[model samples]
Target: MVAGDGQGKNIDDLPDEIILNVFSFFSFNELIDTAQNVCVRWKRLAHDPVLWRDKEYIIRGRAQNGRSCCGVTCSECAHCRCEKTDREVLRTAGSMPQLRTLTMMRGTRARILRKICRNCPNLTTLQLHGCQKMNYSLLKYIFEKCPKIEKLIIANNLLADRRYAELVSRLEHLQSLEVFENRRGAGPVLLRFLADACPKLREINLSWDYHPLEDVEYFVKAKRDTLTSATVRWTMAGKRCVVTVLKEAASSLEKLQLHLFDVAPEEEAATFADLGELHNLRELHCNQLCPHRPRLISLAFQPGRLPLLQRLHLPHATGLPDDAVATICRGCPALRELRLIFATSLTDGALAEIHRLKHLQILDLSGCSGLGGCAMAHVAQLPALRTLLLQYIDDLTELQPSLRHVLDLEQLRCLNILNSGHIRAVPFEEFAVRLVNLRELHVTYEEEDEVFYKNVFAEMQSQMPRLRIINTFRWTEDDFLTDYETDDDGDDGDDDIGY
Candidate 1:
């Protein structure tokens, strides 16, 4: 007869559907803790698998620091790198048995991951990227446990594990595969097996892989009519292998990234010809060669080429000393979006050139060095530049001076100055307050770089209050390599800041 007794009013009060509905609203962790409570009715409601079926998992990107100042929101934050917090949430989210989608990236720990993969039997999609700890056995376990996996994404690691063979073998049920630099040479004949076994596979991504010539040839041999999209990543040094790619797979290829960095061309004419011949290709990303190879750049910009090119990516990774960008921007007039990474070869002159193209909708100046107030002071005058990306450029140390210049971009809708650490803190916070016209803004830093995000965002909330959406991320070498917990202070303070 006691309130805590078996015959208490708890069970008699609510119907099955209502209790399950209530449980469904809570996240995986909240539901778990509540299920373990002494209340019998609450515990009974937790057993319904239907309660967890709606749970979706997504990688949390960097978000705007939420700090308001006297009815105005500030733009800067001290804790932009939300790595530790996001990882903890991901770990807890794995408790849900009926999880349909799972996105675990940026060096996720493998500690409780086996439990995560094993419990989520009904999982339909999995996105694994920058997860340096991902091992062969763990991946095999994941594939076997999640039999219904229709989409699989494993990307961005230099060290290749034997798991590729295991994963490729099990992907017989998989419809799409996204891979980045996976090393699978001696891991059985999995490629051969995948070519035959996975008949339904329509898309395969090999772009960004630092693969060898022989391994590339192996990929080309995998002929399947179901293959509609194939992405390849090769430096000019391995240019000879482009023939294998074109002869074997170009007929059905839709996307390709022929990036040239710290390397030179081994095969010139055939590679360029193959690139031009992919008649069905809709997207092509060709970078200006890094070495003293002006001819390679000549090859990419030959006459009237790449007609179907919808999206183009150019490498402007950091430091626009005297404004090298002004020269680089002349090559691509058809580009709708541009990413000028911290290549240190650009300046106000580069931003000036982008202004000439009427087509640029999106622009990422994340790490282009020397690109502070002086350059943007010029770009603010442009009419077409809508989106701007500025993450992890250490040279932006003089931001206050640039702050007055940057705010001039009133027409800009999305301004992403996410982890421009070198930018002075004073004007950085000031811009977040004044940029009210800014619909979207990002001041990002990842896990260890969580120094000034909160402070900047706090100041920002008080200045700008109309922001509808903000996303953030940690995209440096340290996030994926060098254990976050093992060496919190290891970066000597500069990394994937990888210019």
Candidate 2:
């Protein structure tokens, strides 16, 4: 029987499955305050097991002047306001017996840790961000209550003591652990404890202050067979320790990111050579190393090595020559995403070889001053390119033939041309007409007048309604003064001028 609410068809007449699916789209606050109150059937469906199985709650802090103080310095701000309290979230989560994944961000307190442990015993994934009040006791409560948790992400928190490690070691079923920006350093004892306690752990991301070389070596050696992904950002005390870890985990490691500090020149050659052994490595990100070191690139990147590699990020790698870029293109044929920001040595010759990467989806060559129009010509040939970031390219004037080729790609979603002052508005307007699928277009030309942008935007909007243009050029002092004068002239005679 189809039911009606006088004027239109009734929503209650829909089947329970359809109703539940509709309610699933509603946020937690909306379901509780509006949807559940519509009718008894809607209320029941809102509380169904399927609706609350995977819960995500974002506890945002108060904002001032439209700027939110949610994650950063929320605890320090006295005026911060949260929509739901810790106890209230626990009470709501406790009512859902089938809860499996819980992600709570910002404003999480220690008091709710025990509640989560006692309430959601079946939780397999627990992610908590910007938890200011987290401590040893709260973590212990989680270990005792949520024994089945397999993946844990506690980032930007204050808990980084020995007790925190001890509590983490208690989670016997732990498979993945990501703990970043903690207060204290991850010492040798803590590393050893984690290695011994969590034998099944396959992925670990630790961005703490320091980890002893010996401890890191031991941990890597222990998890060599099981560990597939690891991100370590710490001060380099012993370079050989890094080499040993990479050599040991060569066969199993698939993704690796290392940000080392205070690296000596004597040990760099050996360290870079060790990277070649990781045949199974897929993604490699090396950041903030000693600057102007070209030998490191030559030693590490060898042909026929890292064939399965997909993403390569080498930001801050200054003076990266064209030969190095050629070596990378030849070595990593399966590359999907490549970022060589600030690599000033690369020229058009390097980009010529990049077109061969048919599988390439994202290419970022920002700050590569050596590249010219010829390089962009090759970029236009990438069949699968989706995102192209070319900021601060010195010789990039106009996207002529390249613009047509880029518009041809149906999958090209984002194009960033910030600080590329040579590109005129006319070619861009034409490009916008054919790039119907393009979602984001970022452009900036400081020398051009506001009228130029207004005309370009108006024309582009008329052609491609869905394209989002991000204008990054800031107003000069002259422009601001001119606008003030225009506003003054528009004022009536009765308007007072305060002296």
Candidate 3:
């Protein structure tokens, strides 16, 4: 068979299915603003049902620099407020018939929500965050219109008293609910209603500034048998209530996060005792109002307690002793992710103990001042270790040994070495050739060393074709020192250096 000339084929010549698949990679705003205006075929593919199955609308106030201002009111700043009306935004969503997941962030109103409910009937997940003016009637309208909603997240909203409970009760099929920092409190009636009406509910996350402890206890007790994951934070007055709730749910709960404020030594000890009962728990995260206590860490790793635990996060655990770290490695052999960020007391001995956790894949020891190059030798022994983050660990000067070890682990993909001031360009270049599977690498450098690092990165890119290197240059040390000195009371200043 003789072949015809096939030299110059354009993108427009592609099939509709292929074109639609290409359009699927574009963001909702990109499709609407840019893709649709290209041509007739692109416009048709951009509006296809496949592209709109899962849509998100982020309504942010306009900042002065032509970016979206986050979590702040428009009136308080010099930035021009977002002029796009709620109706205008909803109009785009209303056109989509196959929308299943919808997320609205900041400044969403009831009318806009009503429009979504009226339009997108297939919505199974709805998340609303930092909304200013939400009321009971609007929620009732949402529940009535969208009956299939299974997952709902309402955070940092100004909801009225009893309204949250009423709205939640209306969704009989709701399987997961996350309420964070809701201004008004829910009464016993709401708790009872959730227990009785929502038999399928399996996950509940209630945080900051919630209702009374008694009401929360009642809710947990009502749904204890079916609930699998629960995160609760309460004041010191509600300590006993939390303990009671945890004890009741211990049998079925698989994931738990407890944040207690103003707790005394006795109360903390009492709460740790209840954790032993949660034999089925697989993940645990603890944040205390006071300084990290060694006793609490010891209690958490007691033999045979939380045997199935796989992930443990103790972000605020400052001064965590070496013995506690050793105990954790021994007790939780199955642990895959261990995060002890800001645990200042951890030393090379603790890192040595970490080698026992053979199954650990992710290890974060950011801000652990005592760690040095010796610890990296232990990290190299883990067979499954992949993601490693060691930010702000000031003493990590040597990486040639660690890099040589890291190169052997085929699964090691993401490595972050941000703010480790002593790391130089020579050691990284030696092992950069061996990281064939590395997808992301975050490194820190001084402002003057930008050109040098960029050239190094360009050289590494030639060797590892798939590598994505992120360079974070340091701000002046004086900036940090000034902020640190001005606080006097040891408060974290407004200046954020992560960027």
Q: Per-residue alpha-carbon lDDT of model 1 for 217-270, expressed as tens digits? A: 655566533466665555412444553465566566666666544433455544
The runs of at least 3 residues in candidate 2 whose Cα sits more than 4 Å from the true structure, single-residue gaps closed, are: 1-13, 37-44, 47-55, 64-109, 112-131, 154-161, 184-189, 234-236, 239-241, 289-292, 392-411, 419-426, 432-436, 445-448, 472-499
lDDT for each residue of candidate 2 in 344-420, tens digit (9 for 90 to 100)? 76778877677668899999988877765466667878888899887876545544445445556667899898887
lDDT score, candidate 2: 0.66
Candidate number that wins on lDDT, 1 or 2: 2
Deviation of model 3 at 154, angstroms: 2.5
Ranking by lDDT: 2, 3, 1
State TM-scores per candidate.
0.58, 0.77, 0.78
lDDT of each: 0.54, 0.66, 0.66
Residue pairs clashing in model 3 are none
The candidate scoring highest on TM-score is 3
TM-score, cand. 3 vs. native: 0.78
* Candidate 1 lDDT: 0.54
